[model samples]
Target: MIKIEQIFNKKDLELFSTEEKNILVNVILEKADVSKRERKLDIFLLSEDVLTEQILRKINQIISYYLPQTMSVSIHCDKLEGENKGQRLVTKAWKGLLQCLFTEIPACRIWMLNSRWELKKDCLNIYLEPSGIEFLKGHKICSIIENYFIKLGYPLKVVFQEKTEAETYDVYEEEREIIESILKENEFRNTETNINALSPNIIGRIISGNPVPIGNSIKGTGEIILSGEIFDVKKRELKNKTTMLTFGLTDYTGSVAVKIFLSGEKKSLEYRFKEGLWLKIRGKIEKNRYTQEYEVIPFDVNINEKLERMDTNPEKRVELHLHTRYSSLDALCSPTEVLKIAKKWGHKTVAFTDHGVLQAFPEIYKASKKIGIKPIYGLEAYIFDDESPVMILPPDKPIKDVTFVVVDIETTGLCFDDDEIIEIGAVKILNYEIVDRFSGFIKPKRPIPTNIINLTGITNETVKSAPPIERVLPAFMEFLDDGVFVAHNAEFDAGFIRREASRLGISFDNKILDTLALSRIVFFKLKNHRLNTLAKELNIKMGSHHRAVDDANTDAHILQELLSRINEVGISNLSQINDIYQLRKGVNNLNSYHATILVKNSTG
Candidate 1:
């Protein structure tokens, strides 16, 4: 008989391989505690039914690896079995409620609420982790959960435990303050900044153009789109009598004045261009040589057409670097809005790389999971390095932190056994700023699949001229050499890179950092730690969510910030970061070459 003792902490689980992590996730309480009195391991499980033959086998395997000399293992399972039918019904209802909540909110945000429950008399007590208590008070989230359960016939009370020292000391506070200051100085307020997004339908600006402002000089010609009511019509009594028509126009942005000149036979337009009659004029703007002011000269004029100003939505572009409301004051949109726009545009995956935080992940993951959209989690981090100028390292000099490379890969599918890497995106960071970037799409041995094409917005025509993975991998390897490898899910990217490098007879064992895991440690209060959620919470903006360079760059920013906090916790080296991240050392099980196979079979 195998006995299980003690639960595995979150930190303990970090050291396990991906396969081991998956197995541990299924086990109750995970990790058996060693009992000195019994001289055996004791495992605490949530339910007796969880101890299946497969789980037992894995458990034995783990025990053998850790405690080879042990004879008998003790398994302790505590469950609420043999309950009355009413109690069972209530339990089922409670479970259903929890699932609904998880769907609505990220599990990370409400991890505390997901804790085990106890029934005493008529009151059902729901216990939460200490990290959840603060959000509970400010948001009344507990009452929301309690009222929800109560409506379903179970009266409940919520309880919070004492916080640990780790939970109390937020190492990212200083970094966040710095980021907040940077955002205030840098991020553009969404105002009348749409010149780049101006409609293509508008008449070329050069005709109705004004002198362009360059430094203090009025240089070249520019155009204007003006709409308003005609205020006055005058025949300028000059050497050559000129017809002048002046009108006022107003849009949501502001108001503008327009002028139109009609000559000879066109002077008949003055009759119809009466006062209070609204019209739109498309024209060139020129500086009045006398008054030294800019005014429009009409190229085209329309009668009674209401030219309502439109906010341009430039060709359904995906912003891999984006910030939502979660990035504190740094961002403005919500996760729902971001997801809704993404889905509407048929984007398969969207990423969230927040400023050194993962509080936004839960909402993005939960929202996207059911909708068949993948949410890529990333971070804009800050890193700290030794200030010494010399490159030579003595024992006391400490290993100088040099470069961090954030990487993202897009593949044909998930199974690495057969899947081919189609694209690679990476960003190089030095001193907390992105100094360089790398991106390329590889032509796989097989044709690109329809689903992948849809998922990544990369079509067959896209990779036709590109080189294969073998040719591209070498360049990428050279670019990534000796730098700390960072990715949202470092295991997936690192696994793929490691296996691909192995195939090429190249060796790579760069220190790795998983933003996914780091977020869990730093933003423990967050219920969900997905990239988008973190972006929203931390006010980090995303440029293009899933695309390689954008995701990598965003994650690079996150890395810099995280390194700042990591250093604060006395972790100054890549090895220490790797220790916390527990970098996975196995190949990812992604589906291989589906598109290539399909195309070949069809052709044959």
Candidate 2:
């Protein structure tokens, strides 16, 4: 019979030899006992350094492959002789042997076997190892044993040897004295509570280390607070007597929209929320990326318990880059009309530079701010004579001989003499469609004001970091070589480009067409000519109103509208129409006049 006994003194622990240590390690490994008590045997043997490098390496290999994190290993030894030495050797050998068993066998089953050893009198007598139970307790290894036993339809019990009466009496006396002294202390009474009378509510309030029951209950509606803007609300009818309210709300936490299906009691929330108002909401929170936050929604919202008003200032400051009917032949709305709509859509500020003409800028600028939207002024113009418009806007590969370029320039202030071009934006159109675009903000050889930065979202920081205009202009001219210049107000953009090119010792001579004139001849209903109003009237989605790409795109769209109008008016050839239009506009010079008339008559 193995008598299990605790090794309390160092002298008794010294009895193990390298061989015995190895045998013990092998025993624990074979037993598959991972309990803290079983593991202590490994710790004890490891402390003695009885393991060989080959064995240690094998153990480490197993651990690394099976464990989540690396574990520390140690080996300890004092001598190398006797059954104790043989036992150590056996234990170390057991470590390797146990690995083979555990390679296929589970650690839990080993724990179950170890736990059952306490119940077996012969096994318990032979092993008399208190360290086994202590190690198990430290590692909470008995829980794994309990789980295995439960799965096997068997109950597990941990049995300890009964203590003598004298021993129990001594322990009771010691505990009693300690308890009495603790009760006599003032601080102890405040911190310690009687466990019997503890209720859930009292348990929650108590801060002392007393065990308490945790109960579950349905959460009440009074706990949640909801606030957001009502972006949309729609009422829909259900079967016979039911109705539904679909609403959307956006807040800092992000947007949430819901469809509430209702009958009688559910309709009680009807008075709580209204269209375009803020309201406090109560409902089960859900997670649905497709919808609000939840896919499978659970609770119906109890809304209208609270409502708050928010400021409704329609005009908000935004970047100014928009186009109107005045810039496109098919555009139907004016700059003033676009501003009015922008005001309705809650724009705080607006810009009114028509395609090429600043003509509507004065009126729209005056009217926009009066209606609470700030107004900006700028034009979408054209670049010509530097490169073929085909380079910018290429036609469909199957078609040939139709090309145009639209351009816009931002300069320092409005004075023709003092202000110089600070930025250039252009797009090429071929077969009446935009094909390519160029946008660059140039650093003028002068300082820019804070007002310009605030208005244009451009600053010294940007220009200081950009390449010099002298470097950019040549590249731009090279890109624009031989393209027909198309602009809302052709003269302004063409005049600026011509002036800038001549300053750089380059000639600027290109055929030009004004989208403004084309719009006047095609769609005459505009009260005022501006790009944004015309774009909106034409149902174009105008984004980034003042940016070059946006304005160039709008100009390209205008060209498309013009060609469609020309087709509608029975004009068959674009080259011929463009020549006649140029002659009638009186902007054509002697060379351009003869060339255009020759092209027009020859095409006819």
Candidate 3:
């Protein structure tokens, strides 16, 4: 008798609240289909079986607020005989009321008949049907019912009557009782506080926010362990007296030289050297030049000692030189790939010597250390003299050509000893490359003029904390390994070295070579013979033209190029090149007498 189609219309939809309107729209959208001609629904009126007084109150409130016309809404409890005419009329009236409420409130409605009440003699049997569920899916209608109950401050469980058993329904009285009990138990109640009940360890952990106490100690040999990348491992002879393991070590503390006396079995030390593992040095703390900040010179190093993994600090060890892919005119590799190439070449030591800036050093050092290779610190510096830049080589040997020291000096002016060396950078080179390099700001025995710092980029802040020349010279000498000292301009660096060495009461008698002279001889046709020009001509990369390490490295590369050319021309001995250079220096112009003397010497 109560028809859902008659009540469901746009005019009826205007009666619902905003939230109910949204729910109605969603329900209708879900059920409506363009393909369908008509949709059917049923309406039902049913009493809540398990609903308590609290739930009924909430339901009444929702009905009053959203379905205002349906005030005094009630659940009727009545038994009806099969197909009784009066009972049918009552049911129809109830169904009509449900249809009106569902349609007017702009909501989908479903009813559940309490099937669990069927066994009770006092329970009323009922039929339940959806009033407007054709507008929404069953699950969606159930969600709406749950949301509505929540909004109304009721916590009753609502479920959809199955499609097959649309006429049968049941609800449990015990379910409502259990829900009420749970809500009651969950109401706020604070526990009694007892500060003394906590364990001391628990209290400590809570206070410190750490699982273990800071005071906890681990038992071991009390020996302090240090792990670092081996910057350089060279057999150095110092003062023409002591042969020592003059190696540079870079760790978390900082980079410094570790001078180990080579009295032990050479084979034993050699095995550890070949292992090429990052070393864990356990030795008594001894201050050494190579030891940048902290010194631990072990008399015996266990090469087998496990290398601890450490993160490379970007601030400490930056790539002073590197070449990008864009450097096609000279360099053939990217900054990252250059490190890979160096690693492949079995070069435990490498410096990025890229033209200008320490930009690439960070990435290069990070990548190199990952592959178990320690990079030697250096930069290939270019020197500009009289508007012409020059490359300086590591000094020659007796004074071995392969083993020479790379030195960088920041001077007040070009006159060497007259212009004090304000800063010094030195690295040892063997086999035509940098093995290790040292860099430090030096306090000029005299005030650093503004012009000097501006030109050299060495600020007062940099040299402010630098050790005095007296302190720096001795450490520098030890780091040099009495090897040939080299720089971009040999005369400039040699003058500073000789002056500084004298100041320290030590004599520096190492042989010297100018890479500028070497470059001029090898690439004579180049228009300009400056360091930058020669580096570009020879396809050599450089970095920070004025910085000592960078300039030193540029000098190193120029030396490499010259050595390559010498080897090409079948000149195996460096002594022959030195003799030729010396002879050329002796004669301003080669007359017949000089030519005959030179031929006689060549034949001899």
TM-score of each: 0.31, 0.31, 0.31
TM-score of 1: 0.31
RMSD of candidate 2 to the truth, in angstroms, is: 28.4
TM-score of 3: 0.31
Higher-scoring candidate on lDDT, 2 or 3? 2
Candidate that would win on lDDT: 1
Model 3 C-alpha lDDT per residue in residues 517-564, reported as the tens digit of each score: 655545656655777887788688877877776777777777767777
* Cα lDDT for residue 249, candidate 1: 47
| After superposition, candidate 1 runs with Cα above 4 Å error | 1-400, 575-604
Q: Candidate 2, residues 1-604: lDDT per residue as tens digits? A: 0001121123433445556445433222222224443342222232223555555454444333332232443333333454354344333333343343345344423332222122342112112134444544555444533443333223344343332223211223122332233223312332454423223211112222321111111222122234445666766443334445657765444665544444444354444446765444443334332111231111322222223223366445554566667666634567777777766766665554345555666667577767766566666554323111212222232222556778877766766677767778888877766778888888877766546655666666577777777887887787677777778777777787887788899877766777776665455566545777778768777667765567777877877877776666556554445432332333321112111110113433
Candidate 2 local Cα displacement, residue 565, angstroms: 1.3
Tell me the lDDT of model 2 at 533: 71
Model 3, residue 497: displacement in angstroms? Answer: 1.1
